[model samples]
Target: MSLRAIATFDVSTGGGVGHGLATWFGAALAGPLRGRLEQEQQGTAFFSASTRATERSPRQEYQPLATGWEAMRQELLHEPETAHVLYMREHLGKPLVHVRSSTIRVRRPNAEAQLLFGADCGSLDDVAFCAGAVEFLVAALDTVNPAFAWLGADAPASEETNLDWVLGRRVRDSVREARKLLRGYSWTTVCPEELSVRLGGPGALAATGAFHRVVPLSAGGCDPAGDRDRGGVHRRGRARCLRGPAPRPAARCPAVRPGPPGAALLPRGRVPLPRVTDRKREGARHADATARAVFSG
Candidate 1:
């Protein structure tokens, strides 16, 4: 199984976002991640180049990571419709890490920039690598300061699956709703561990701040069900009565029947969810909202 960790954030269509991402990527490759990779005999140099896979010519020559990132940064700064996929591997057909980015465009308003780290865990060593990579990526969330993010075990096959499972909407509907809600909203810091605790373990986490909010979705609550009727579609329910002072009013809380082990739902407009789907086909999709009832009894 391939374990993946993703951090998605709201960024302007400015050159600074690209520059900041490039700088962070380079620093990660040369700093903390360097020692971890070295311990596994997969040093930073092993990821020497970036491979751009295409449909017509899925195979393309690789370029040094520095070169590829620099080129991507430039394109992100200058090109409004820039969409690129850069992945690293020991050789062709064996991907270890992936990074994709695109500038915000008018055509698709819900899109957000994402930094993903993944590794296929087939053996003990591979599991270790995946663990290390996930740890680094999750820790980097504080630095990246994403509006919303998630870490999962198996990657969803497509954007539709990701959206349906995470937000309980199809791609088109989700994007439209997100674009509408995203306006007049700002970004804030979301702590993953803290979110996990607040959600009562295994559900989407959303919290309000003075100006912004953060939501963290967990694997257990966000996993998809096999039954189509239950797949990514959550049913509304009343909160269970609890003793002591409630976080908020139970009557105000809107609850959803938590799915099996891979899906969670947040009330609409809780926080801006990143459209971290396929860029080539879908462009960019974003959604935003505040969850006032999420913390209710």
Candidate 2:
């Protein structure tokens, strides 16, 4: 119930499973900080082809310029098997929080986690980019392969194919289980594609997204000293994120500080500036009153 947002992503050509999983994790991250509530309930999401598996999955493995991303886009125009997910948004009916992961490895038995998404520092794409994305609902799940060769059956019956559907139903039934573990709630359903043809709901991990980064709230920010040159344009306004080429202030603002209230007002329309604590304002008022009293005498 509290997870008003969700995101799901996957590498386009290879590592589709990992790509799929990251989006859900990312969306869970960006939901609660409390910004303006989005007018539409969800946002678009994107999935990059896994660079990790690019070399392995013939479709996308190529030079950086060749396999970097452009080639991945053109390929999506043709088939579903490609790892990148560009169609999920318009088709799936949910918002997506697009993301990429570099240097990912499945560490098992003992368990250690680090920043799993970026390739390294100093790259824009090295940070999270939810846009420049074709969006969709990403409903992903890992369930016990329902069709596990039934020991007694000769040719696995159509019932075997229906295992995934049963899993989806399980997900719906155990939706609260995920909520309790995560300490937040959202509707969950098992919906798998391409793995098996039978239709039964499977238990799943689900989330939502759109027009967002869906990154962790505790995410480490990008560099700052790199952005100090832009001058006064942003200082007078709201804060700019230093993650990239944004402006920085504190050369100090030029607005002149007004003198005391008792000070004679110049013909120009300037109100006395309020002091931080108000003691100055009171002192200025008292002096102004004294000056007026002497002038009258």
Top-scoring candidate (TM-score): 1
Estimate TM-scores for all models: 0.45, 0.18
**Per-residue alpha-carbon lDDT of model 1 for 118-210, expressed as tens digits?**
444232235345345434444444344333333344445233324443334454454344322221111112333322343343232221112
Best by lDDT: 1
Q: Candidate 2 overall Cα lDDT vs. reference?
A: 0.20
Predicted candidate 2 versus true structure: per-residue lDDT over 38-115, tens digit per residue:
322244322223323333555454222222445443442332232322112343433332232222221111110111
C-alpha positional error of residue 56 in candidate 1 after TM-score superposition, expressed in Å: 14
Q: Find the 10 residues in a row with the least total lDDT in model 1.
A: 221-230
> On a 0 to 1 TM-score scale, where does candidate 2 land against the true structure?
0.18
